[model samples]
Target chain A: MNAIAPSFPAHVQTGALSIRNLSKTYPLKGRPVPVLQGIDLDIRPGEFVSILGASGCGKSTLLRLIVGLDPDYQGQILLDGQPLNGPGLERGIVFQDHRLFPWMTLQQNIALALKNHDLGTAQKQRLVDEHIALVGLRGYEQAYPHQLSGGMAQRGAIARALVNKPKVLLLDEPFGALDALTRVRLQQELQRIWVQERCTVIMVTHDIEEALYLGDRVIVMEANPGRIGEQVQLELAHPRQRDTALLFQHKQRLLAQLVGH
Target chain B: MSPFKALTWLVSPLALLALWAAVADAALFPANLLVPPLEVWRSFADLLATGELQEHLAGSLSRLSLGFAAGALAGLAFGTAMALSDTVEAYCAPLFHTLRQIPSIALIPMLVLLLGIDETFKVVIVAKTAFFPVALATVEGIRAIPRSHFEVAAVYRLRWPTLVARIALPAAVPAIVTGVRVALTRAWVVLVACELLAADSGLGQMIEMGRQMLRIDVVMVGVAITGVIGFALDFSLRRVERRLSGWQVAGR
Candidate 1:
């Protein structure tokens, strides 16, 4: 554990991730198909920011770029005032699917991110155990990915992503695969975890309600040369109730904007 | 289930054996050509007592193990390399794929002519038989891994060794195990065929010797033993696969 901190400091006081004038285009056949154009956003340290847009709006693309997963972009992504070249341990991501190794148990899958860390076996086990319990998956350490339900698997994914204790955690519709009820429950859990960990989180989603419920600030993007159309600051206190008047009001407004009402 | 229905399933084999015994007793064929079940069983017992059958079985099994292990390991390495690098895939894929098209059995005649009917020829045949399926499965397996896994690995800044060990190997295990099972079965079958053709001592050679000596009972014993051994080997591998992937079953 002592050696782990020196090799890769998981926690540090850094200006969280910052994206400026970032643009991405896919080469389709021959001509470039522009996905994102001149998108600028800043996720402050310990803030929960959500980017919400309709389908094909490139919200997910922004998250990918921020996490340095797709480095074939045109603009600068900075972390702690450092230029982002590629992925780093300071940034973790959870995709739509669990992406847990099918052959590994829940414990092994969660501990995988720690493999590169200079941690001892006992310390690694402790880290895995802490994250698993944090995600409310305590007893099923030996269970494999296939043994878990969809929501549980995503929780496992969350545990794995957070195990590295990244400065920024990027999520691409992490709860989209779950049922409506499960989605709501997990949203509450995520809010709780974010408050406790104080890790900057940037999530992309199409759900208006989810964006309002989770984001400290929600950025709405428009498709066809994807760009930010509007930004909504939720100004609500932490550990917000699901059916608060403010949540409902913001949800209606965002839904109206999303559905062109 | 009805008791009579269960009884009917047992009757057919008993009836078939009775018919076979009757035919042999009636001397429908020459005594040298058609051996009774009792005679076959006696011959099997005699061989078992003398340890002849065990010696031949052990020899064949050892060859199967060696050839399959060597071939499967090489296949994994080659397949992983091909999947990882475009240069290796582009330059060697066509040639490798073309060679895989030729049936392993078809190469037996040419291999025997080149290397003679020695242990090397038989082992080589087994290795070749095991290689293609395992390699092909491994290539597909590696390709099937989702890009998301790589993204997560990259985000974690996983080192090369850690990425391969933690992400790549575990993700590819199910496919690799499938390939290994295919290789084992292929090697087992090919080794037997090779023994029948050229080996000095093996179950297949024993059957060949029986055929030459006009001992139908001994040949029948060898045939039964081969079938049982093949079934056992395949069944054991299937059990291993189940154990390794048992979490899947539990989830379902």
Candidate 2:
């Protein structure tokens, strides 16, 4: 932990993100099918926002559009009042599947994210090492994704996403595939990483408890034309207890909203 | 390699050899018709010492290498293009499938009639034998790569070359290696058949000459050598293939 670390790229800028009247639609059998519609939201710099919804609710689709994986959408996604186009180094995403290239070692997978950056060899190595440490994967740099357990692989994915020092990190159910124990463990790790790095985070998940656990604000979504239904703000500070009465009340309310009459 | 493993593999072949020696000694068939195992071994030794076996093996291997290289390379390029682009797939898929269905051996007579029983004909037969499985493997490999993998590449904004090298190439390597192994052994078999029918200087030619001269021992030597060479080629390639796709096994 006392290792001298090379600084992030000076050009990297963290910014507040705004999604205004954002709507995405795909043609199904030559008919327009809307996924995300008239979605308006504002996220402060360094805030963690979790969007909650059921399957087909376009929760993942929204994350895809935000990460610039799909550019053919209507409306604005602005970072610091500047419209974002295609994918860039400033935006990083950890998908549900971990998505690490199986042939590459964990270090190579993380190093690959920095391919477009113009850092020196030493700086790149330092950043890769630091992030690997940040996610508590200190000694697993040379392991392949296949050799890792599911939680470790997802952590590798998170390290890869964060190695570029992005302005915003988009996680599409980053811990969706892990067991309940591992998922909860990673949530605590993510909360610590978020506090240390101070970058804006937007994660999409279906779990109500996960939404309230780490998010400063949880955005509940409705399906069949995915759009925001409600928002719950947790004003508690960092490293709050998971079973607090306030969080439990919010979880019950959210559960009703998610799977209720 | 452990001595026990080596001994275990040798057991079956030794049993077959013992059976062969017994049949020859019992004289169920005439000596000329079913040559004794010792006579075959002596002839094999005689050819090796005189370097005739080396000359024939060198000729056969050269043709196999040339033809397999050309065919496999073309198949790889064509298969990748087809997998990547609908236009390429639409144009080439039908013709490619039809050509693959026609076995390389079946084409030997027509090819000999058209191109004559020359080095070119034998090489063409080998190439044809190698092409289909390689192409099919490449296509399946590329197609089998998940959408999730591509999404990761897109998210990172990887350039065209990096995307192909890091993601596409390795992901498809296991299937392509398997395909190449199948093609290599198939091409060797087809090449030997072509040589037996047409060429003047290959293992198949040696066997053909022995048959014509009624020297069953020489022909038996060629048959044994062909089986051993094919087995060695396949075994060697499988090692290479496993190395390339070691990740697949580890993942399981």
Candidate 3:
């Protein structure tokens, strides 16, 4: 492990992630039930944005749409200047389940993301190794997903997602399955990684505290034609202190919005 | 895992064997009808000394290999095609299911009539016996693979060859291996039965010859040898199964 924490890269190719008049509907018993309606979100390059909502909210759907995992939607999603039609290496996703291939070791799983990259073998290995180390899973490169704990598996997933050094890293409740202590530790570890990588991160999380802790701006969402309820910007700097009053106040207000009087 | 532990585990089977031996030697039925284990062993040694047993075994094994190879290859291709295309599945599913429902043993007489009591007939029966289980397993295995896996492959923009080589094949390996094991054991039994009914050579022929000649001891030897070979084949297949599915055991 490096004693010197790597600094965030300053010269990132800032891609404007813009969603315009986005909407989604599902066919329920022959009727179209709208999930997300007339939604607009613009995430700046290198910014950490967290979407916080209740269980039935379309927060996850929004992430899926941006990641191009779900393409059936009515509106334009632009990453930088390119139209988002399908999934690409530029956008990486971390699912709720670790989704690591059971047969693959940690290193192999992460390296799979770089399968299409036109890099030399040594360079590819270097990136895989670096990402494994980045997620604090340095020595566990050869460990299978089944051999690892929940937190460790999720870390491996994170490493896999970040191995590509994507323009945007979409997280669909990545730490939702972890225990309280593990979640907290991962949240901190996530911040450290995000700062070092400086990739635009949009995470969908139900936990208000988690959103407040990780996001530069936490967007509260409401269900039943899911749309943004409110947006709260955390003025607190990066490498955030967990118990800060700013984080606590944001959490309380976000909770109020989520639980609606 | 200890020898003593293994020995304790065998107590019931050993007791049963001893009881069987005692019953056979009691002369309750004619000694000629109920051949004793010692006499069966003696017959087996005699056959071995004359090279009769080895010759029969070789003949049976060669037939099994040929039949099983042809059946397994066809089954793998057919199952994969069925899984890949709804059109193929729709056209063939009912016929496939109906054929699978007919036990291979039940088809022996019909197959013999159609193909004659030649080598071709026995090979056909053995192949038919091996085919269905493997095909059914392959289809189920392929279908059981999550759509997410394909989506991952698509996201990476993997070519069809790469996808099959890296993702589909490995993901379906456990099921495919299980199918192969089932087919192997099934094929072994079917070959012996066919040989008993039709073939002039092989272990089943030897057994049939012994029965006709009224050598009850030789008949007993045939039965015991078949049992042992069947057990050995299953044991080896199980070892392969465990080794192939090592990942699954780890997950459990």
Of the candidates shown, which would achieve the greatest lDDT relative to the real structure? 2
Error of 1 at A187 (Å): 1.9
- Expressed as tens digits, the lDDT of each residue in B1-252 for candidate 3 is 888986895898689789879999788888888887788878889999999999999999988888988898888878887886799999999999999999888988888888888888877877887888888888888799998887767666667767766776677779988998889888988888888888888989999999999998888888888888888988898898888778878887
**TM-scores of all candidate predictions against the true structure:** 0.90, 0.91, 0.92
TM-score top scorer: 3
Q: What are the Cα lDDT values of the candidates?
A: 0.84, 0.89, 0.86
Q: After superposition, how far is residue A131 of candidate 2 from its true place, in Å?
A: 1.4
Give the worst 10-residue stretch by lDDT in candidate 3 chain B. Answer: B152-161
Judged by DockQ cut-offs, the docking class of candidate 1 is medium
lDDT for A139 (candidate 3): 91
Provide chain B TM-scores across all predictions. Answer: 0.87, 0.96, 0.94
Q: Candidate 2, residues B140-202: lDDT per residue as tens digits?
A: 999999988887888778887787678877899999999998899899888878788889999
For residues A1-261, write the lDDT of model 1, one tens digit per residue.
112211112353664777799899998999999999998877777777888888788988888887777879998888878998777777888988888877788998888788778899999999999999999999999998887889999999999999988888888999988899999989999988887887888889988889888887888899998998889887776677788887798888778777877
A105 Cα displacement, candidate 1 (Å): 1.8
List residue ranges in candidate 3 displaced over 4 A: A1-10, B109-118
- Counting clashing residue pairs in each candidate, in order, gives 0, 0, 0
